[model samples]
Target: MNIKLKTIFTLLLVAVLGTTFCFGQRSNIYIADKPFVQEYSIKYNFTNERVTLNSVVSDRNGYIQVLSSHGLLRPKAGQFLFPGELVNDVQYRPTSDKGITDADIYKNQIIYIDDKAVLSNAWAGNLYSRHDLPNAKLFSAGQDFTFLIADEMELNLLKDSETLWEGSLNNEIQDIKYDSENDHFFILSAGEIYSFSPKNNKLELVLQNDKLTCIEVAGKKVLAGTSDGFFEFDAKSKKHISQIEKNLPWPEITTIKSVDGETWFGSTQGAFKLEKNDKFSYYASKRWLPSDNVIDISKGPENSVLILTDAGLAKICRKEMTLFDKAMFFEKQVRERHIRNGFNATVSGMTEGDVTSGSMETSDNDGLWTSMYLAGEVFRYVVTKSEDALQNIRESLDAMERLYTINEIPGFPSRSFERRGYKYHDKKWRRTEDPEWDWKSTTSSDEAIGHIFAFSAIAELVDDAQLKSKAILLIDTLMATTIKNDHYLVDWNGEPTTWGRWNPEYVNARPIMVGDRKINSSNYIGMLQTAYHFTGKEKYKKTAFGLMEKHGYLENLMRPMSEIGRAPETADDWSRMLSESWNHSDDEMYYCGYWGLYRYAFNDELKAKYKEAIVDHWEAERPEKEGLWNIMTAIVGDNDYDLEEAIWYLQEYPLDLVNWTVKNSHRKDIELIPENFREQTIKEVLPPDELRISRHNANRFDLDGGSDGRSEYSAGDIWLLPYWIGRYLGVIGEPVQK
Candidate 1:
């Protein structure tokens, strides 16, 4: 009876997410490849060569093998194979299953080879018999999608595992980072650098090639160290474009890391660096780094560089690199580039649904920028959690301290240098590296902002005067360099429209007494609150008052004018000019495109204005999806709708609820923004689907319009935030894992 109940509940879950209502009735789209099996204690069977797996393994060669859950095949030496007809290397059809490819072997059901195996890595489980790995801790677990894990049984046979990974000496990984932007990991293995997404149920082989010395991912490039020398590979095409063999003084390339638009590699002799143009330079020994023999490299914000050497972890930073300095970096890139492809098609087209022509950008989410922010948040969170992150905080503080003591600041007080983050490039946007803060320029301000956030987080967690003082120095420089006017901050550099609005000059330089009611806005309101806590700077408050009281900033909410405060260009245009406003003042919570911005909004006025905007927008668009004539299902989880109206909207934007719920563990009101919908009208009644998604597959032409942009973090920002918030506030997430 219990089993039957479990089965029934599972089917109900499927029904909740599977169906959509078009007019008044439900329309479920999924016609399963086969009916749901309900046999008791089913025996293992491999009759069909290909099977849809609940979980699987991924491998390097791009080909995957499988272990059938219902097959009689047993495991051997960590190598599990399909029980039935093993197809030839060339074109071959599966003996039984339809559309089964060599790559799909591991993608199919996990054939448990051994029971009670515990060779789990932090990212994936056991790695051998079952594909039970965990998602990489460092990478984001994107909402509304499911990715399987690879087990050891498959790993042992997939690639050449003879050599121990460099970071693992008793087989323990040093660092495991999954780049959700690029969709791969930076793994340290037995003296070699391995870059790959987990192959949960895949089997392919790569014979040994010892020439490889280092491997790293820089934007679209994959850098590798080889026998002859070093080379950069195309991340998409997987083609080796440039190579310099035996170029390094040292023979072995120990590690290669991507940081700030440059590729840094470590070898037995020392450390070396590479620019996007493939220019090679050395930074090893006491002169550039502590030791020539480098073991690992981790790049952090504020020109901070972490190098793991024979002498332990060594951190290097230019003393001047600060929050104030980073805006210049954004200014430089925005001045040089003009490429926008992600979601262009969707916005322009009136088709029921479709994708826009947007190229994948690198920094769409500003990982580096967010990293700086998150570092501060983490600093506070972990410190408050009882010294959990104290070691990290201490080490980070110590590193900065060294840079301060050394007086190694970027040369430019106003200018800065930074890597082109997640930005797609065209020749028109020919991004040229700024020479001023190129190599040793003193980066500041934003670095100060970062320090302030970090230090404040630390201060909140633990009273640390040294950290507080360091943050203070950063603000002092920012105030000195950034000229203030009319409750706004103008850029220190000369006039230029930029990206990310890191450029202060462009940010603060809104034409006053302007035509078209020039609405210059920013999220600096949050920063003001942040700044007031530490600096007690009344200017921060004054700036907030200027924007709210003086500019009539509330009028521009969703007006198609410079919104989001980061870009002036429409979805296609690079609006760095607008982005700068966020740095100068607050009120940016609205532009963030997530529920948390609204939910956790720090500034009360700004928060209220944003809520009005969301509600107003909801009211305005509520009718188009449908009038208040439908039943709200899992599909329509928004604030502006009653149960019936939201149901109509769900019918209008019917997504594959069953497939969606099965895939992702997250509640998807709109990516992470779903939390905001809890108190909304549609949420009061049982939604039609099992879960409601804020953002759905984005393209008209594509079969499934899941997010396509590599860098567009806003892709599901509102969706996920609402969902997470909902989970937090009893809206929705996954059911109890147990």
Candidate 2:
């Protein structure tokens, strides 16, 4: 349950200067920097062989670096500088028998920096790091592929793009399945909840409290869910019998859902419906909502139970309400049942030659045919005559056109932007780098631009005239190269930049513990509002109305409230309403500047100044109980499902959530949902989440503001700021009397 905090990017651990200049420069010049860790003691011999030496490691802040490599040396006093401590002339590639021969890894040594001290290149198993040096591949993949094994993306297991037995929750896990006789699965973390070994993931902490957040398994009974209420333990006397109480017009809780006893909980102060005399009642945003800020609800597929919130997926049904187009036809029967089992859902790479799995791979295999690029464009647009929905849109589009490979190149060219330190994801984005070294810095900016806006939203939702003219010639070849470089983009598509060169120092990123730059170009005018609804292009709606009027959005007019395509809304306010000046990491830049001024900023006193910057950012940071019920009391489906505002901000805003291990960006299409609104929508795929705080305590809070992780704001900042205060400014997809 990780959502809250909207800040971060403070030099993010700093280090990446050297703007440009080179030579023997001593591995590049006398280094007194870059050795956070490079140890290897095990013996007296040569940690294999391939020598080089230079030494120094000071850090009172003078910050310097040179270090070079080949591998194996230790002469700084005990200084064993072997191979005649090479200065003797460069030209060597020794030990080609695959190096390291156990003197306990031949005392494995390989660190670098030369012009004067701060060097060693001993050698053992993998420090191939040396593209002519500079943070020599930053800590040169040392300690055998970097290792920090902590930082709040913890409580885990890898591999999720497609199963190790249906695994899928990296942050929405709420288990408890005891299945028939004795099979187990009961999880929950951070404060504590474990029960594992469901066939060997192993763990057994039964239950510890601090207001547990989720856990389920109904039959043998074990349903937890809490902020203040819900429990049911019974896995063979690990006893807690049944606790239920705490429920009202607002007591908290978040999510529960049980089936037989009919329970359903969802409570950050709203949603409830118990029955069986466990009696709970209470559910509004007005007779079953699209917002009250709920996070996840499950119970779907027939009697329906999918809800999600903060304002997106909804499908209640009991009293009536099931449309986003039948939850995009229950996300096209769960992406045609995961493309009939051949599920790819790729995000990174691994298809090999001519590439595929959408190209680029050193082997992190990010395979996605997105159930066939989203049921082959929802079978050209619902009207499905079913042949299992045209056999899952012809095998998820023959696996997204052979996966990935139609012209690709880059072993380097800022190959993932100077390869940086590491965060280079491996959960899949088709891994290749960032096993988690940390991240130094460089650039590439918007290289793939979320697979070119999900391949231009699958060629503009099926009207694929040559894949929408090859996604408008690849969005004008990435606005003529990564949005025309404003030092890696911040302006060039008509002012207000920050979308193209989005740098969170990519590696294998866990990002978003508290990072902000607010999701690249905060809804980069929804890429000129999807190229002004595909080619209606008034220069893509006047360069997305000049990036929400020179990029500052809801500062005065151009969006905040509503007036649909504008009118005389407020004399165009401009900076007058200073409800504490404003910032939720720039509220996805005023929710994409009021959805690019309600789908094209026509002006209604600037969408009531973007609707009074959402009730003046809750009357300047929530003016009392409306203090947004202490900063948002409900509606949370993802940003890690906010465990009731993460245990009341780790007991009142403790902060800390910087876990960047990014490489390739793994997000194998979970459940997208949107085929003209799938029969009216109600999809639920939950089963991969596991980050219950502890990627080493996920940065140990204190992230008071410095994040840009999740790379600051991109779940499209939960739809350009709750589609203007949640669905076209309330009424859940508009209509209370319009």
User: Among these predicted structures, which one has the highest TM-score?
Assistant: 1
lDDT of 2 by residue, 1-738 (tens): 122121111111011111111111121111121112111111111122343222212112211111224332221211111111112212233431222211111122333322211233343424332122111111111122221111122322212111122232233233333333454445565456765443565556777777787665666677777776667778655688977544333445666656435666666544555556543444433123334556555443334344444432334433222223323333443342222223332112222100112221221111211321332333224233335533444454443333322112111111121132334543222222444322111212232333334434334333324433444444444443433432133221233232234322321021221112223433444454544443343665565465455553212232322221211233223212212122233332333223333333345554444344444333322211111122221221112122223222222211111111211111121233453201211132111011111111021211112211211111111111122122211112321120
Runs off by more than 4 Å, candidate 2: 1-271, 275-282, 289-325, 328-451, 456-465, 470-472, 483-487, 490-738
Instruction: Write candidate 1's Cα lDDT for 3-84 as tens digits.
Output: 5664454344223421211112222321111111110000112223253222122233322233233322221221111111
TM-score of 1: 0.31
* lDDT of all predictions: 0.33, 0.32
